[model samples]
Structures are given as C-alpha cells and as structure tokens.
Target chain A: MSPLVEFRSVERTYPSRQGPLHVIRDVSFTIERGGILAVVGESGCGKTTTGKIAAGLVDPSRGTVLFDGENISGFKGPELSRFRRRVQLIHQDPYSSLNPVRTVYQTLAAPLKRFRLVKNRTELLHKVRELLLTVDLTPPDDYLYKYPHQLSGGQRQRVAVARALTVNPDFIIADESVSMVDVSIRSSLLNMLLRLNQELGVAFLFITHDLSVARYFSWRGKTAVMYLGRIVEYGPTPEVTRLSAHPYSRALVASLPVSDPRVARLRAQDDEVGSPDVPSIQNIPPGCAFHPRCPLYMAGSCDRDVPELMGMRESESLHQVACPVVLTR
Target chain B: MSIRSDSAPPASVDGATLMSVRDLSVVYRVGNRLVRALSNVSFDVMPGRALALIGESGSGKSTLGSALTRLLPRTAEITSGSITFNGKEGRVQLLDLSSEELRRFRWRDCAVVSQMAMNAFNPVMTIQDHFEDTAAAHGLRDKAKIHDKAYELMETVHLDAKRVLPSYPHQLSGGMRQRVLIALSLLLSPELVILDEPTTALDALSQRAIIKLLRRLRQQLGLTMIFISHDLSLAAELADDVATMYAGQIVEYTDVFSLFDKPKHPYSVGLIGAIPDLSADGASLVSIPGSPPDLVSLPSGCRFHPRCPLSDDKCERELPLLVETEPGQKVACFHWKDAQTLKGSDAFEGRNS
Candidate 1:
C-alpha cells in the first residue's frame, strides 16, 4: 500500500529583502498509515512550515506533496475538502488556539456540524461528549458548557485534541502540541495520542524542538532532524537518538538536561562544535551549514562541498546522515 | 550516596549559610476570598552555593522567589514568616524592612533575574542608557565611572561592550539580551541572585550555554543563587540542593545528587520519572494523575494525596510535615520509602484499578 503522506524532494522559499530565501531545502520523508514521523528542529528551521504543507495549509514552492501517491498540489474542490477533513493541525499554544468566547460544546460541535458527521442536536451533544471522553476530559457534561478560560492549560490542550478528533481525521500535524503544557501533565496527553495512533490508526507528524519528547512520543517511529531548512539526518527514532550520526544531532542529544546530577554535571562542558550562534539562512555557509560548528569539520572539502543525505558506516539500518565526514565513511 | 541530616551539609557545600527562611506563608486577597499562594515554605541558601526551587506552574515557586525579594504584587501579602538574610552589616530581617529601606536593600544586597528579564529592558533606551539608569539609581553618578563599569561587566558576560552599548534591546538576540540582563543584575555585585527560569525562552543550545555561563559566574562571584525552574533535570546541573514544591508547600528538600538518585518524596519521584531521558529507550513517561489542588479550597489533609500513588486514608486526613527522613533529606510523604524502588512505569501502576 502507498504511504499515508509523502514529501517528494519538497522545497519552500519566500521572497525577502536579502533575495529569494530558501526556508526548506530538499526535504523528503513519508508517514505510513497509522505510523508517526517526528520532525525535530529548533526555531526558524522550517519544521512548522513542513507541517503546514502536510496539513494543506501552505503550498510548497517546489516539489510535490503526495497524499497516498496522489499529488496534493493538484487537489481542488471536493478533493481538497476531503483532504482537509482527513488531516488536522494541532497548534502549540492552547491559550491562543482556542476561541475564548465559544463554549467547549460549541468548539467540538462546530467541527462535527461542518463535516456533517452528526445530524441533529442530540447526536451533536452525544458526539461532543464522546470526543471529550476520548481525550480524557472526564464527565463531559461538566466541561461541555465551560469556556476556554474556565479550563487549565492541560484541559485546554485536551479540548484542542478533542476538537481535532471530532471530524475523525486519519492524520494529525501536532506542532509542539504539548510544549506549552506543564511537564507534569504532558505524559497523559502524549499517552492519549499514542492510544489514538494504536486504536484509531491515526498517523502523526509530530513537530518539536525537543528530541527527548520526539523520542518519547514516537519511540517505534521515524525521526528527521532539520537544520537550516534541510533534513540533515533521518532514521528510526532509537537509532537516531541512541547512535546519532549527524554532529548536530549529537550536540542536541548532549545538550539535553538529564535528571541525574552526577551525569548532567559531567556533561556541562561544551559538547558542541564551533560557535553557539546559528547562522542566518540568508547568509548560510557555502558548504555544509553545520560545518562551522562541526567538531569533525575538515578544512578543505567541508568548506567546499555540500553533502547530501546518505547511509553511514555500512549500516543496513534506515539511518541516513548529511555530513561530509559521515557520508565519506 | 548516603542521606545526611538536614543540618549536615553535602560533600560539595563548604560555604556558610547565607540566609534562612522559616514558616513563610503568603496569601492573596482575590476579591473576597483568600488564596493561599504559599504555606509553610522553608528553605536555605548558603554562600557561594545554588538552591533550586523546582515545581510545576502553580506550585508557588515564583511566589517564594517574589516573597524573598519583597516584590509580591499588591494583592499578595506575607501573612507570617521571617526571611533573615546575612549581609556585610550582619543579619537583617528582609520582611520587616520599610519601603524605603527595601529599595535600598534591593539590587545592592539581592537581585532577581526573571523569565521576562530579556523583555524587561526599555525598548527605546540604548544598552548604555540602561546601564547608566541602573547605576545612577544605585547611587553611581559619575558618567565615566559607570561607562567603565558597564564595559567591564559586558566583558565579563562575553559581550562586545562597544557594539552592544550603542544597540537597543530589539537589535540583540535572545541569548545576548539575557546576558545583558545578567550583567545588569550584577552591576551592584549583590551577594544573592535569584534566577527564575532565566533561559526558558531560549533554544536548547543557548539554554545550555546560558546555564554554563551562570554556573561559572555564580562560582567566580561567590554569590548565593536561588535558581527556580520547572525542569528538575536542568536545575540539578546548577544547584547544590533541590527543593521540590507542590501546591504552595515543599514536598522534598535534599542535596541535588541524592534527590535524583533516591528521592524521598512521591511527588519528586513522579516528577523525575516524568522527565524524558535522551539515553534511555523504551521507557514511557509517567505523569502524576489529577491536577493540583485549588489553593482557595484545598484538599482535606495532604494536598497531593488525591493524585499520590501511595496515599491512604491516613494521608487523606493528616497533613504530613516536612520531616528529616534521611540525613540531609527531608520529605513530607508518608510512603516515600515504599515509592523509592518504583521506576518510571511502575510508579503510576495500579492507579486505575
């Protein structure tokens, strides 16, 4: 069967004062039916843009976004509406994503009514309460009439998740979905998503700057690391985190704050290469974007040649890296 | 690592106790109702050492920080407590100071670096103007002397003095702005510095860099630092001691090293287990079930009993006091010893049953 969603060498650019700025470069990946693909990167790395393209919110400047082998750029009218109903986007900030004035019942019912999933008021109320229950907002009646302001951050996020599920979408682009929630209650939300993926067979394109969160939510799934709008590394989540090939990935893994004081104390030393600053996309280096900060950076070739993503260390695993040193090895 | 009594210092701490807080309770008058922001909160910071206040968003960590600096909002009041700070002029009661005396005490004796410090700068003012304004307020009037001191501070924080001095706050990056704020906080060379989630807004790389810089500055300046963060892991790196708070009360307090390896509180264990580890694989994050108790109408006894895995009938009726369970480790849980062996997955098991 064809993958649920695929990016075929997608590239996105925007016109700026400094010339045509390439926000996404040569990005290609796929999310299988009921599978998860976590895109991990920091701010201004185009992860959010990639998520937007997948959700049909933005059109890519170049290349095709395939939905089950059908190019999404060609979608129009009924086809586009069908795609919209099948895929959803959950934003980062629960505080702002929700409509403050609308009651939770209205928020969930609007989607059901828009998709015509429920016929009458009775069905809408029952479906809305069921959606609330699905997202672990217990006793739906208590939460149905409450406004967004009446709920906590975690509850607001749960309502957001429930609203997404109202239309029965097969895929979700959770862009930092739980980042704004408190750490203590984050796991419950993550576990709810996991249950949806398993029981409902919903695919997830989880976008976050946190690698640990990516690994936690998509343990048995795929992970793609982006830097300067490029997919610098891609592989199974365990392989990417446990044995990171890219220097950038290594730096990210090293920089994660571990709970243990003894372990975290020893890692206080600078594990990253080069300067702490990330160079602007407008003034990206000629060769590898990460070469300036790469610990294993070579003097001549690294500064001259742009490396493409390739397999590393003769590994048969799905691990691939875009670094001159790793590609040569 | 063996647990020591509360009085016994950890192997790393050799400095003298700089300040001690006793029975710190803060209440806010939200209209007619009284909201208990903090209740019976107590902790200590030693000279040249860091004490981390760790908790969730509404756990009163920020309230304690504000109470220490006497910067509480108009609605909030310290109902009962004594905050004693050891200064060059000997010990002083911080809460007892008048508004005028408090102004003189602030920035000169203790300083605060909050999450908004980066955005706290006046957007219209140049970096030099900010330095001049702060220094002048603290009684440094000479322009040339303030300029020299500002340049010295910029150099100390690894910023180019000449370039940053002429630029406004909007011109600098998030990391650079934070560094400038830190430099400004140290303008008076205050003995105590309270950092409340200083790097929460920065990226991972910048957060790591800022943490390293703060650690170095704390040691070099011999400053007593109270680093407050929701991230226990990040706090463990910079702090000598860790105090975990929940619902305005401290649940656990111990040396940083011991707190991680053998947390004596169920809440602390649950929090540590909830953190996603980079190296560990196949371990699921475990969340403490149920939300925090409403401060306006708290639970019957133990505020955390509603969500605690080891809670029983006794835990629901009697509020457990912060008692020394081990040497140097204090816990307020009734079943911390039983919860010690519980791992990430096992910590929250049998909850639904």
Candidate 2:
C-alpha cells in the first residue's frame, strides 16, 4: 500500500539564543493511505513540530515530505493552498481553538465561507449541520446558535473536529487534541477518528505523549519513539512495543504505569524516575545523543560515534531502532 | 517503598460529621441564564482519609474545588452548601462566607492546590513570597518561623528548599511548580486540603513523584483530603476512596481498590474503560458513544442512560437512586448487580493496576 503521506529524512532546526536547536534530527516515516500513525514522545520532543511540518504549517530545515508521492516541500501559490485544504491541523486547546465570541453557526460557517465551499447562507447552514452530525454532535440544530462558552468541553472538542473537517481534508495532523479534553470523552473522540479513517479513507499524523494511547490509536504506517528531538525507534507498533530495540524506547515502555496490579506493585519500588535531559542541540555529545543515559551503553563505542536510523540487528522492514545494543547483536 | 498511611485517623468526632456539605451547588452566569456548573451535590471529608471527587470537565470537579476554598469567580454563586471545619465550630457556608471570613479561612482551615494548580502561584512572586503571605495570614508572623516551615514543606515534597525558595514560578519545571504548590498547601498544615487535578498536567515521572510524596505526607500529617480529578489512574494511585460524579451528581462512591477493580455504575465502568493503558495489549481505543447528557434537560431516569449500553426502558423513565450495597460501595444504577458481570475486557478493567 502506498503512503498517503511520507517523511524522507525530515529535520527541523530552530535558531536558539546560543545556537541552532536540532528539533527534528534525521527523522523519516510514512502514513499509509487511511492509516493512523502516532508519533509518541514527551513534550518538547519535536513531535508537534514534525506534525506541523507535515501539515505545511512549518517548513523543514532539511529533507522533504511527500503527499500522494508528490514532493510539495517547496510548492507554493495555488497548489500550496490546495494542499492546505486537503490537509488540516487540530490544535491542543479546544476552549481556545474556536472564537469565543461567535456562535457555533457563525464559527462553522466562517470556514465554509472562506474556502468558498458553499455560496448561499441556507446551503452553508445545511452543510454545517451535516458536518456536526458526521462528528456525532447530533441534534445539530441545538448547537447552531450556541456560543463556545455555552457548550461543554466535549462539545467544544467536537466543534473543533467539525471545524477541521470543514475543508474535507483527507489528512489530519491532530496535535495533542484530546490531551486538554476530559478523559471520559477522550475515548469517544479517538473512536470518532477511527471511524473517520475507516469510513472516509482519511489519514492522520497523530502526535501525543501517551504511549498507550498511541499504541491503541490503530495502524499508523509506523510508530516512532522520539527522544529530545530524534526518532530513536520507528516501526510497526506491535514490533516496537514487544521488542523495544532502543534504550529510549525501553525506558518509555517501562515508564508507563503497569495495568496489572502485581507488576505495578513491584514497579512501585524502583526509582527509575524519568528526568528529561536534552543537551542543547549545538553542544551535542560526540557519538550518541542518548549515551549519557543509555543503560546498556558500551563506553567507548556509544560515546565515540553517532548511530544511524536502521534495523541492523532486527528483521528490517519499517522497524528502525537507533542503538548499538540491537545493531551489534 | 514509602509508607501508605502515616497513622490511622479516629472515626468518631463527638457525634458530629467531619466535613458537612449541605445543598452544595455552583453556578457561573454567562449572560442571562445561569450555567449550572454544580447542582445539589453533597459529600463528607474525614480526617486522615481521602474522598476523590471524580468527574469530567464541566462535570464540576474544579468548581467543587474552588467552592471549598471560597475562591470562585465573583460571578459564581454558591447557590447553597455549608462546609464546616471538623475541629472547629467555625461553620462557613462556602457560598455564605463573609469576605473577612473568606480571608481568614482561605488557606488556614482549607487550602487548595488546584488543577494546573502549579499556575496557582503568581509568576512574578517568589515561592518565599507565597509562603510568607500564607504564613502571615495564618498569624505565623515570625519571619524565621515561616521560613523554617516553608523549608520543611519543601523537604516533604522532595524539592530543594534552598534553591526553590528564591526562584519564580516560571523558573521551576511543571513538576517542581506542582511540588512547590503541594509544599505551600502544607504551610498551615490545614486539616483539610483540596487538590484539583494536582498531577494531571505533569508527566509520568512527575506524577509518580507527586503521588509518592503525597502518600508520605498523608502518613506524617494525617491530612483530610478532597482530591478532585478526571484521571482515574492517578486517582487510583493516591485516593483511598473514590466518588465518580456525573452531570453534577455522584454515580458511585467506594473504596479506591473496589472502584477500579469492580465499578457498580455504567458511567464508572465506561470511565475506567476509556483510559488508555500501556500495559494492556491490543486494547484498541474505546470511547463511550455520544456525549454526556445536557444537565438542564437531563433524562428522566439515569442521566447516563442515553449513552449507557446497559440501559433499558425502565432506566429511561424512572431515576435510579444511590443505594448502599456493600460496606463501603454505593451505586445509583438501578441494575448495579448486572454491572458485576462486566468483562475484564480492554474497555472495562481499570483496577488491575
């Protein structure tokens, strides 16, 4: 299956006070058509930045992102606008995502009007109601005249989702969209995305810090484990989850609260506190950026040279892990 | 690794309730109509024990927290609810507290470290300034006394007292700020402390740090706590007892272990199932279909019936009452017995951990 979206050696560097910050370091992955690919990492891991790059909100410092096998990295003008319409980005805060002053009707109508998706007000209103029902925000008429403040948190999130679908984008870059919403409604929202993927053949570049959520979020072409600002491990969710080749991936899995009471009780004794320590991009270590904290680090080799993204010690497909432990083995 | 409880608390309190919440409700008026944020809620908070008020947003978990502290926005009205301190007869209807009484009772009687509560501190103010203000308000006028107490509080939360005392809120990481807030809540050793989503904004490491620190603190001080949160996992990690609230009403209240292991209410089971668990494999994401019912036009029977998979016609017309079944567990579901048949499927098991 060809990918609806593909990242080829994508890198994003931000000019910081002291030097350039390597936000995305030699990252590459793909989201197959109708797939949900989640990039799991802690905050400040450049996961959000990578999502923005895919959505065309941020230009990459190095490499290209292809959509439908087309290199639109430098594409601008009408073509870029069309790409923007075909791709949408959902923000984190639903409360702030919509205009507080406008009613749901106006807010929904504004996008349709801007995109010129509909001309007449009557038809536009009908289309707005259609979008609302599609997202399961039923009895759409009730929400038509309601202001953002009048709606509940879950309702607000649905509005945001409806807004994102206003342009009928085939690909969505949902960046922590559910993190800010209540946990009770979050599952339903994720299910909504799943349904959309299956029903509309839409693709998603989901970004989140919750590892479990990413795993359950369905078959993203590849699931990548990001550390500081690098894709340390990228592979099929099941493969990477079962045999986490990279040290960072191992730590991440171990960090998740064990759902089994027996294991959680035992884990409660370990003091493996995750204190994120990312070196300033400029003053990076000689060989491996993760060597300082890597538990299985072989002193000389790990510190002397950087590891590339490869499935050297594993049956290579899309399962890419950056570690000598796997590579040397 | 750390002690679970500092010391067991005495149950009898001279024949009086430890914490009494009368017809407690909170409403924030937007334009013309009043948004019923919380409606006719009541619960008790006992010393040396925790009662977690669990609910999703707009479910009024934070509103409930703010009501306990008399810190609701000016527009917000405490329609009714008299929160009386256990040790003292100083009863103040959180809604009825006079400005002076609110000033007096703010942190000394019941303190708050709210949701994203790290932002509770003013960014411009130093941690020392926050401590001094709180201590002075409680009559800890001696500068040295306040400073010593603040250092001790920091130590309790594993914060570097010396380094954090002079730093600003912006200077500390999310976890550090949370720890500072927890430390500040202890400044007066307020018998009852209200924490709203204290660890929700934090990472797993920070969350564990807060949870473990709180467990230790509970043992040392025997603090009466009212923990309000949306995250059941964290709630299970800390709260001894849990109360799952919905549409402004508690659906279930029981021991933390039982609540997670076997929930009596459909809403409780759905809440537990909805959480994404990393340890559970192939646990495809499951979301409760449909949104929470509108409180204004609440369903006649169980407010959760519309979205509840177990709902029947009887559930739609007649309301279910919260009846005590087991020793500690209470449920509002008309058919809670059927809930026992809940599968330990990917969506239903929240208690294993």
lDDT per residue as tens, model 2, B1-353:
01112111223223355576644667777777667777666566666798888888667777777877778888888765556556564544555567897787767778888777555888788999999987877777899988988988888888889899999988778888888888888787677888888877776556766777787788888888888887777666677788888887778888887887788998888777776676556655446666666655566777888777677899989767666899868888988988856544444322210
**lDDT of model 1, residue B43:** 69
- For model 1, what is the alpha-carbon lDDT of residue B284? 76
Best by lDDT: 1
Alpha-carbon shift of residue B79 in model 2 (angstroms): 3.7
Q: Total clashing residue pairs per candidate?
A: 4, 7
Question: Which stretches in model 1 have alpha-carbon errors above 4 Å?
Answer: A268-270, B1-16, B350-353
What lDDT would candidate 2 get against the real structure? Answer: 0.76
Q: DockQ of all candidates, in order? A: 0.71, 0.43
Write the residue-wise lDDT of candidate 1 on B1-353 in tens digits: 11113332222322356788877889899899988889877767778888999999889999999999899999998887678887786777888889998988888999888788556899999999998998888888999998999999998888999999999998887878889999999998899999889878887777887887888897678778898898888777899989999999898999998888888888888888888886568577887776777788888778988888888999999888888877778889888788776666657755631
DockQ-based CAPRI category assigned to the predicted complex of candidate 1: medium
Off by over 4 Å in 2: A99-130, A139-151, A166-168, A219-221, A257-271, A274-306, A312-317, A325-329, B1-17, B29-32, B88-106, B294-301, B311-319, B341-353
Clashing pairs in 2: A36-A220, A37-A220, A187-B287, A188-B287, A261-B352, A287-A305, B6-B219
If chain B of candidate 1 is superposed on the true chain B, what is its TM-score? 0.93
